[model samples]
Target chain A: MNDHELDIILKKSLQPDVSVDDTLFNEKEELKNMKPMWIIKPAIALVACAAIVFSVFTFNNNANVTTNNSSQSTDTTNAFALKVKAVGKQVIELKKDVSIASRYGEVGAWGGGENDDNNYETDYYETFPIACEGNNIDKITYSINNGSFQIINVKGDGFVVDGEKVAPLDKGGILPKSCSDRGITNMEDMLAENYEEGYYSSFTVDPDFQESEDVIVNICDNLTVDEETYRKIWCFSVGPYKDKDISKLSKEENIKMLELVKEGMNDVLSNVVINCTVTYRDGTTESKEIGVTKIVVTPEEAKTLEGFKNKKVKVPSLYTAYKAL
Target chain B: MNKVEFEDMIKQYGVDLLRFCRMYLYSKEDGDDLYQDMLLTLWKKRDKIDYDANVKSYALSVAIRIAKNRRRTWSIRSRIAPESSYEQMLDSGTQIKLQDSKAKQSSDPEDIYVNQEQIIMVRNAANELPNKYRAVIYLYYSADLSIKEIASCLKLPENTVKTRLSRGRALLKERLEAMYYE
Candidate 1:
């Protein structure tokens, strides 16, 4: 048949019949039958059990609880002090070892130079890279405190802290400034080159943070992707630690710790402000669901917030971030 | 209208929709899935869609957009499917090994055998055409749009569509004649 005649017949043969109703449209009303709170009960119970065990083994045994009389709050607040003490802090090994000193407490401190305040001043670095992917840092962090950070050195593959041109870390993995002179080489250089005007973004988790244990949160001076004012990004993460049973976390709480870790890391590594979203794995999505959107704050802005400055507000560590998970 | 009315519209044009879907997709499941997704899009944007003249064409337009997306999605996996070649698939890729005695007993040449042989022939002929011309032909013949319609759909001048159509027809004619001749 010629095309038109054939098309007519095809149309006639294929016309849809409307008499039938959908059989596969079965709604799972059984879900409606359940009490709305039923889903959260098991989660609450599991959290209660874990709280008891954790407090006993990780806390009660090591209790040297102190009632600090800070005007911030009147409640007995040293609940995690013993656990923090038991966690056992480690010192970083650098030429002049530096310790992180943020005015805020409970900011998880993962990696940094020792005696950073004496050697480093209050200038935030811009577009720095921790190379946490190759470094295999699962959530490196820093504490937030009162006043502006006088950042001298960044924890990149190398340091340009205070313009002294410090040497870089990895023998092979990280690209140095010399390589930056060579046509734009890595993710860090690309971010630095593209940082733009004074922009603030809600801290967002790097979309690809799932496959590797590294989370890099770039704190931008501008909210949009402007390279000119864009200063620093923090890098931290918990996984591809693949073994930390993430199934226990509420998707929202899980993303929060990642945000803090990322935010804290960026704060120490660079000098600029960044807003990020805690990006995490969605059960079925190839894309991550951003959890507790992390907002990067300048020390000045953070200090202005009530109940925030100087006091160690664990500000939700992995425990509080995923405590209910 | 509402979802029920929208569904009714889909049901009204359903047959031509299935035919168009089937012509593009080999699997019935994929065709049905595309249909449902198209229906959903139509339902969601029911007020905005101009379904005046030909609901079938309007729905087909929606189907085409969704089908292309599905094709892009599936190509990631189906790129390596064994059906890539008519030669391999037509031959069954699974030839029964004949015993020595059976090989000697077979009188007919293996090349003479056929089942739905025209499908292999048509596919091979189509595969032989260049992509640009093949696109016009596939849209006109399988998608069942008219030449003028195909030109508008492709955003090409009608003359260019006619030229490509002629070029495609010549290629298929040449291949078919040569194949049937010897």
Candidate 2:
């Protein structure tokens, strides 16, 4: 078709029919009558800010009360930070070094009680075996190749010779030494510029905030109430979720509540009133709120303790089993 | 803008916006729905828009943006359910009309009949154009937007818009000729 003919036809086809019904008129009218964003935007932001502040205040206030109650009680020893590593004493019985033949002597198969006409009895040993080892006292001792001696009192019942009750295996004595182990041996190795390494914890920003960067993870260790113990917590700093973005969520309030829950758990883990302070690469420090629940040390946590008594001791291969001295 | 002013703006530019959308999109229903959505968007963003600026151009730009976004969403949806997208576009019997009219033709037909068929073919051909070319064509011809204005609206280089327009015209001509001869 020529340009003139095409143009005329296009105009004719493109134009809406004058008689066409406006089915969408009501919808359009509703939209037109809708409040302008200038008013709604700030209103929504204010509501969101009020919501966040209210939530943070209420949540932190409740958390502070819980912390104070837990701390004031004279039983701080039982009060583990939510899920701190709990290591307890386990007493494993030492197995006796006795052989089957020594215990049973000679077994006679199909032997009669007193006498049998055609006896199927067979004697394995010419004489009955006596007790193999001497009836010694309840003291167990081991000398490496008959050199230096190591003694463990069998009847001591997990008590040291001084009569002090000691845990069979104590984790408190085993301090953390590696970053992953919750100990920062070297600050240089533990601090990461990007999300690649430093502990990546998660924290929600102000409901009205927008994040330019991703959430950064940092590993933080604070000395616990027990001077010897360092409470290890992961600090996560996430970019803000803007009000508009939050509004896009199906349940913005629910998400905000979830963020509050995260904050609550982080508060319990870090034991901080607000955000925990984190040191950056350039020695500049910033406070980043904790985002995730603290890591709990299970009873099955690998034993990190090295020596028993100035001597390198090999722990038993099995978790609950004990290695005899 | 007050409610009356907003309603008036919609009545004035709504038809032109719908035309741009219809020529730009494959489905008239999709275009119609998109037109309503564009009006809603304009109403919401009315505060940000400068009253001194050209309202028609702004509406055209908004229409184009909405069309682009809808196409993007459709493309993603089509990948997930290709048959559903095809059914949606062709469910209105436009494809059937195009197919039926393809073989039956006359060396010469009545003026009204020829005009009617040409209009259908033109709409179909414009719809069949690639999204980039279709967008440029609609803005240039239907919206009467300058090449520079189209580039600004689509956030593309002026030279890119010009190239697309030339390619789009050539393609549209080919589609029309194919309908006529074949």
Candidate 3:
């Protein structure tokens, strides 16, 4: 085809009446539009933030293939600016009775349930099935092993006797921690940055307004408001989702994914209802000014949280659940 | 520099942009829809725009980018639309063949002999060309852009732009000669 011929033909193909100005840019709306922020822990202390619209985290053992429930990581990296870490107390009880080959009726050194290697590093702990009998309470003495030692009473009722009650564990529960628990030993040394390391007794994002770079986790305490229940609350922000990206969700997608995650978290939170609000640029607000609603967390997640499973803890009150947006 | 400049910019480039729009997107409705959207985006981004930069270039760039994106969307929609009606036979049907016989029917009575048949044959031949060549030819004639300008607007290298134009021209020449020159 000659250039001129092609030009004339192409030109005519474009009907003169056709208007060309109506292009829409929906690039801002991506598939992972409404999801919570999550991280894939690579190692201890090297905690890094990864952002993905949709991602899967899985592990397998032998022929048992399991597809993990997928989740979206939507947290703003800048929101977790405060780098802090916390060391929570966890009492790992090996449910099965462990023992040695029964050498000489002497119950030779080989039989025990506890891993002694871990004993040297506990923030606070005690040995059991030992030589001491009757008292259940053995003579308490301590060593800091790698770090310093501070005695803490693990009440038989399961509360950490640290001047006040924290989230209590059952007969055997790993000590709970959050981004707020890194203040026990030395707030100065522990709080070197956001996501610090150590135990903290409480949380209330100090200087909260300064766009927190800190994410503190405590191994020995519970952030769940009421100390009576002994249940821990883990709170993290997916995003400041107040702007256009989330608002763009066509009332349907936002709601669908929100229901999914809320369902997933239900097992852990037990009837935890998420209250949500959206603030638009027009000075208009979509708030619980919308209304309060219940979200049934998933059954699998409910199993992970002892509190969620218990007949006791009050139903969770969270306004941050994804809306039908 | 505010609404007036934006409105003025639209008025000046609006017709040319409309011509550019018609080349790829078939429907008049779709083209105008895109044109409005482009104007709004220009107005929205007005403050960030380099006031000294060529508004025509910027608007054309935005239009092309938007057009490509819209084409992707339309392709998806087209695939999903009813298999028959959405394929745009209005442009491809025998009307264009009939149009092939009628020359530019200008009322000037100047007897310039602008055979509408020649124009229709030319249009069909161009439309039948590969999308790349069709686009280059569209930009060259309909958009009145230089090779370098087309390259910058489409984010292609100048050589590629020239190549597309030359190749597109060659194809059109071959097709038109085969169909009409005979």
Interface RMSD of 3: 20.2
Q: Please list the residue runs of candidate 2 whose C-alpha ends up more than 4 Å from where it truly belongs after superposition.
A: A9-325, B76-120, B144-152, B155-160
DockQ order, best first, reads: 3, 2, 1
Sort by TM-score, top down from the best: 2, 3, 1
Name the 10 consecutive residues with the lowest summed lDDT in model 2 chain B.
B105-114
lDDT string for model 1 (A1-325, tens) is 2344323322322221222232112123322221111000010111212211111000011122122212233343221110111112211111111222211122221111111121211111121221111111112122111112112112342211112112221111122233334453333343355321111122111221311112122121211211211111111111231234434766455454345444443443333222111211222211111111123333343345332334332322321110000
TM-scores, one per candidate: 0.34, 0.36, 0.35
lDDT tens readout by residue for model 2, A1-325: 6655545445544443421343234655655443211100000121222221110000000111112232134432321111101112111122221111111111100000101121111100001111011111122111111011111111212222121121221000111122223322222223332111211122222211111112111122211122111010101101134223333444434344334323432343333222223222233433322121222111123243311112221311111111111
Interface RMSD of 1: 19.6
True contacts kept of 2: 0.10
- In model 1, state the lDDT of residue B110: 38
Candidate 3 lDDT over A1-325, as tens digits, reads 3344445455454334323233332323321231111211111000001111112111111121121111122332211111101001111111111111100111100000111121111111111110101111211111111211111221232221222223332111111122224322222222333322222222111111111213211122111222211111111112122122533544444444344333322333232222222222233333221111224323344345322333221222112111111
Error of 2 at A319 (Å): 36
All predictions: root-mean-square deviation over Cα? 21.5, 28.8, 23.7
Q: Candidate 3 clash total?
A: 64
Q: Model 1's A-chain: what TM-score?
A: 0.17
